[model samples]
Target chain A: MFDNIDKTDINELGEFGLIKHLTQTVELTQESSNKGIGDDAAVLDFSGYKTLISTDLLLENIHFDLRYVPLKHLGYKAVQVNLSDIYAMNGIASQITFSIGLSSKFPLEAIEEIYEGALIACKKYGVDLIGGDTSASAQGLVISVTSIGYAKEEKIAYRSGAQEGDLLCVSGDLGGAYVGLQLLEREKQIYLENPNIQPDLEGKDYIVERQLKPEARKDVIDLLAHLDITPTSMIDVSDGLASEILHICNASNVGCKLYEEKIPLDPMTYETAREFGLDPTVCALSGGEDYELLFTIPQADYDKVKGQLDISVIGYITEPAAGKEMISKSGHVHEIKAQGWNAFKNKS
Target chain B: MFDNIDKTDINELGEFGLIKHLTQTVELTQESSNKGIGDDAAVLDFSGYKTLISTDLLLENIHFDLRYVPLKHLGYKAVQVNLSDIYAMNGIASQITFSIGLSSKFPLEAIEEIYEGALIACKKYGVDLIGGDTSASAQGLVISVTSIGYAKEEKIAYRSGAQEGDLLCVSGDLGGAYVGLQLLEREKQIYLENPNIQPDLEGKDYIVERQLKPEARKDVIDLLAHLDITPTSMIDVSDGLASEILHICNASNVGCKLYEEKIPLDPMTYETAREFGLDPTVCALSGGEDYELLFTIPQADYDKVKGQLDISVIGYITEPAAGKEMISKSGHVHEIKAQGWNAFKNKS
Candidate 1:
């Protein structure tokens, strides 16, 4: 639908003019938003509930390959990543401030496309774009989003609240994003060597969408509330399942025992990993970018979430003296380790 | 002092390991911060008052030149720039989340130096470093900060509250930051041509510091509070005096008449402008990054702030029919236009 939009050079509109053009149609929908754009700062009144805040930075090449990633998906993913943090805390995402440092290479319409996707996400999630600042970059595009949320003081679930005997649960399936990335990389190489060859991604739409536009699992949070179950501790699985489990254990000063066979994985992801000559179990453990919430609940809450379509009971918390471990389907015990994505190592 | 510290490669530490090392010593002092780092999101409790939010993105090379700007000063200036917006809204900066995207070129110690400077600024401003994220970038450095503040419901200022016949006022001097930038660029070019020649910056400390370590006018906000004088409209002078005045006028649907002779300029700023063969008045009108507060008050409150040491009553708001104009020192009339920094044009 946006293919034929007029192309205007971003330079024709200065920073201020560009901001006006993008935000002129944004109508504030939140009762807490006292003021939105066109001010030194946005004013919000969250007098009844505790405020929650989170920030995430997304760089061009380090975070995603602009060569294959569409700008619209990139913008959508950026907002999703930050909102996932708020959801992981059992908070209602209310508003966000999205800032960008754009290079001159992006025309005004290109930026508008990114904004269109971001606004779509905001509308879907009922978030108000209260404030943001834009600037020029010397090189690639850079995006930083800060999400503001709220929850009752008693309803908030922190990562340091889990204890022994708590069941570990993860919302949504994992490893699909990683498998999808492999598909894209393979296609990219083929295109690089022979520009005329089309991508061989038929029937791989599930994994590809999982990689390009992962949702934040806000529905799972609401469902748990409706089911009258409160998790002891929670976090979003962004840096792979293993790394996130380690974070929860370290923060709560506890240990965990995960079952390799119980970790949720989509059938498409499993077959794709096999096709790529990779282990599906390892993909679920080490592959990142699955924005699923991982939490621990008491034994009494097991019946409340049992057989849920979106959640999986993966393991249980253990004493601190028992180091984190996992049990294989073949009845073998093994140490769990995190070999997830390390951004700095990629640069080095 | 840090020269002998361990020069650990950022790659070796990994993203999570590096964040733990850097933030191991951080302590949350704000009562509003219910939970700090080491969680999916930071929890805050802005219970009794309205919350204020603002964000800014700073990119290397586009916003600053490393040749003349120290990493420490750059970090300090980043915090200052964001806090200025809070004060402009008549609020006290309570907390900030500072995130950075770094490249492999920066070592662990270099990142530490930047954090140290940011901590110093936060300490000076009585704000807490609540949460942040670190990531790797493929290009130059990027810093994004989001500041949270609070103000009484009745005491907050907005850009759309100005009325005709209100007095226009400004805090501190203008144009020093722009001239300081010129001086630094000149010295940098000289050093590039002859590395051995030292920079000739003698007796220019005021303007140089203005550029390198500009402070947000929290004291001015406090003064206005103590004087029981709430501004009808307010904005910070990051985009020069003229642009800020225009923002107020546009938002408030009013016109303004600024007296050229009444605009404040440090004597050093005036001399430096003349030395560079530029007009001091024009510099004050179009130069940016001054980080001063421009506000308007009812004419009845004029006697209350008539002879303040740091404030100057520069003009008065006019009816929308009058249009925005500046009375030249030579008794000539000229329309005021915003020729401020255009980030996109700089790259184009």
Candidate 2:
């Protein structure tokens, strides 16, 4: 699929040579990093800080399709999603270990594209690429990333910390990634049906980029720290807005009322959803892969984030008796349920 | 393959339900583990110690053959191999995050069997299962494990610390895992040709266990600490004795002379090699997956570990000009070369 690229057989480099070639450019900048690649394990010093760890596994034909997704974008999105987990806990990511399994179908140059994207993400986020393993796969490509970070004990946020009467907030926009996927799949089908026609992705750059190269909401965490606001509960919006809200409610033994009209949606996402006969509200409520941060803070702390342009006050926490509900734009109250993104629909 | 077990559909539990069900019994026992599952990221307090992180990727049909390897054994062996990396650094493993991608061919019971074995290893090694991601694969099983641990700054060992006059030592016997693999493959071939035949595996339990259920050498680290002896360099023998010794030599800018007679070999491994018309010494030199610790220490510390039954002094380090060489039983000096394990030979 990577046309015009020199097809260097992966066997030419072998496992050790490939690893050394890929990691030769890594320059450790983290004070915590004592030793990196070329050892049995990476050594670090998280003295006086609580360490945070998160891992993710992405399998081809399951979590992603290489037909439309660029290898560079895939690597970048993978790192961002994992880093989002650390930021979701109000931590700063310091290092990441990435492991990949590839079939012989992949050339050395193809692997390099993926690692280049990964390194770009690490460099952009000021995170060190420490250690990882590479192996041959029996089928499609497989990627697994482990992100490590640190936070002060008092600054760490958990899902069970929300209290009644707290304001539920979200960062940036939602549903863009899900809408973007719809567009990509539609274009892929059209191309399969007619090879002569080019993909009509005009004016869809915003949502497409969101899907292919989403960034972790590290800035939001930094913003909260700068504002001296430690959120009572926080989670990244990786599983759609409604699902994340319900997670906070269930974990905290409370209820929530999310306002559909208040949910932020980029105009392009709404327009594309309408074009595809999909309800933009439903898309934002159920669509996933938006790496925005969702958090809850006490009502008294509202003034701290009220005027922040990137922050949105979308709902409020309620008593358990109230139940988890959503107020639609049409003035109807409905129970909020989680329709988690199922990437395994084809196989099952 | 798992006979006499209920084959509950994995889809019945969904992704979230399956994760909850599998991790329901995970009781965090480490003081370093401030928070584990049910969070965005696992929170660990390694405030006073340097942290060590290691990751490994295992792909079915590449790293293992499930026709003969049990699910539980695969799980246990996966954890042990990752932990062996931490122990190779002279560190105690404290936590592990395990991620697995499975095809729909697997039942919920099959997954539970794997997780059960993994949890057992964690309990036995006093490590906690903190966090991980689960997903569906399009083909065979894919497993990625990340092990975390800690050690005092002065107690950690690195491949670059070997000195010219350091004594080379190895723990446990070599060549057993490789021989075990040979026997299993032989049995598999026999069974495949004639299903009604009962494969002859009597009296081979030791080597078979070495291949299927190897253990990390945590006791050796504890013993070394008790004796107040710290090695100058160390590595786990996962890629054969020659490869590991060469790694130490290259990294430390030194050479070594390995004695064939001093290489510890279990009598079963030796006899099994002979039975297969393979040279026992060659197997010790090139057979991988032993999980034995190979280290180099100052010659002055030899008396401290001289009488230890598990510790064997195999050789001594020399100046770089001497080059890496191994002495045969007949006193013939031959240059030592690394024959690294290649699990991907079939694919690549």
Candidate 3:
């Protein structure tokens, strides 16, 4: 986090001036990026490569609470989530257009902090900040990011490409981001009653970071390529494991049999969910915001991903007649239901 | 505008269901579009072409007033504004990603109407609605659109390519949208005082439509292509004529002399500004949202565009030492200034 010692008024720089100032340090490193800012549109050359495009809209109060979220982390997470979509298709993100609308309450320094974080993620992920728009909002902050990437036609993965008997796999642990949110909300309430409490977040750094800075599984995509394995179907785990499984099943016209015990859960997430009197398995199945990549590989190619420390083989595709089901740890079978993140349900 | 007779609850469909229902009519018409919705990211094949990317953020109450602006028009205008950026680069927009965040007050019918308008624009513009995100907002409606297009390497125009002797030209008329906005505001004020007043918008249909629904100058781009004229520099007139001239001048490291009489203005726009006790010339100079193509071509290409009904030669690029100036109808020279749309100016 950066200090706001110099409180500069946003109006002084105006809209165009602020955009130029924020993107002054942006340098395009991608060969596909022929143009960056300072044009009607950014120019890119993706010859001989299939382009991948994804967009995400994040509104304040609905998608995030600024009280518990730092501006820098918010910016970083915004880019990561969109990049996760590209990785879900087994593509490499090369550029992004980040548009933001915020009210007058935010000072120039605050806006700069957000841009600093966004640029950091772009640099770390090897993507260029091509073009974007900035405007004053009527209320809270608003962010929309469009990520563009590329992949070979043969290497691209689609949700409907999965076939029966493919092995279901997921990268990294699940339920961490969801449990991390629960911890943050708890701390927020406690601090609201007495602000001097300093938020008792000791030894809770892992879950807290998971909630604040969830990373896209780019390393996993690289590993898959290195291992010469292409997922039959792939998607990013953004709306919980159960929801993602249903999406792949419905698209591929297949059902799945998932083992409850095989669902990977970090120790911190398990203990944290337990402390909140919530079922860990339910948290992993229903809780969301986990930016891990979920994919499937044919059984014939299972040997390539076997014993991969970062991967968990939790299920297998079945005929549509079998229906989506999960075998619980107690040897009981239950139909898998999706309680994915519903922004409209509660708001409406 | 479509009627919202049936009030369908948005929660019934949820986020995923709503997105699926809204985009069900979308069909990929572009050969570059290999895949669209129902995936993590849209797959596009812009092989052998330089891709152009642009984005815009529109906020309700800040960018538009829902009281007077219909949902359908709002949706159509949002896509049109973003497409204008691609046209400004002398490229054909092939696809767009439209993302929206709206409050629960908007019923399912209202959202459908917006999508209906968006799809109409996409079909008419020969662009595909590739992918986007729909979310619930905590406040008013928020729209973000990203347009993707392609052009050959040699055909792409940049703002910095203008030369000192280039002729500055603009397509279509200016100040119509701004004056149109003034007329709408007057009517809105009258309606607020007495709801019975049906808004005296009888002969004002021309200007009214200019504000509510401004089309991007795609025809002018096609015309230029037909005439085999490659502009040295180009930009869209979204931020007023004077502001855009300054941008071209600053980027090209040159100066310009814009003639007051050469500025194009519709008869309705001129009369409306005069009735409001505002200078018609000033309105054309500083009032933004024109969505016309502003470009500079070499002196040798003047005959190619001469006698063109829609195209107007407004000025001529000059040496940097000449300074940016505007010649009044009375033969007086004055420094050109930009009072372009500034969202941060009055708010902060």
Question: How many backbone clashes does every candidate have?
Answer: 0, 0, 0
Which sections of candidate 2 miss by over 4 Å? A344-346, B344-346
lDDT of each: 0.91, 0.93, 0.93
Report the C-alpha displacement of residue B16, candidate 2, in angstroms. 0.4
Query: How well is each residue in B247-311 modelled by candidate 1, as lDDT tens digits?
Result: 99999999999999999999999999999998998888899899999999999999889979899
lDDT of 1 by residue, A1-348 (tens): 225567787888889889999988787888888888878899999998999999999999889887788878888998999999999999999999988888877778888878877888888888999888888889988989999999999889999889999999998899999999999999999999998999898999999999999899899989999998888999998989999899889889999899988999999999999999999988888998999999999988999889798889999999999989999999898888988888887677
Ranking by TM-score: 2, 3, 1
Q: What is the lDDT of residue A328 in candidate 1?
A: 94
Query: lDDT per residue, candidate 3, A14-102, as tens digits?
Result: 99999999999999999999999999999999999999999999999988998889999999999999999999999999999999999
lDDT of 2 by residue, B190-222 (tens): 999998989788999999999999999999999
User: Chain B, TM-score, each prediction?
Assistant: 0.97, 0.99, 0.98
Docking model 2 quality class: medium
What would the TM-scores of all predictions be?
A: 0.98, 0.99, 0.98
Which pairs of residues collide in candidate 1? none
**Across residues B236-321, which tens digit of lDDT does each residue of candidate 3 receive?**
99889999999999999999999999999999999999999989988888888989999999999999999899999999999999
Considering only chain A, what is the TM-score of each predicted structure? 0.97, 0.99, 0.98
Please state the error at residue B196 of candidate 2 in Å: 1.3
Ten residues in a row with the worst lDDT in model 2 chain B? B339-348
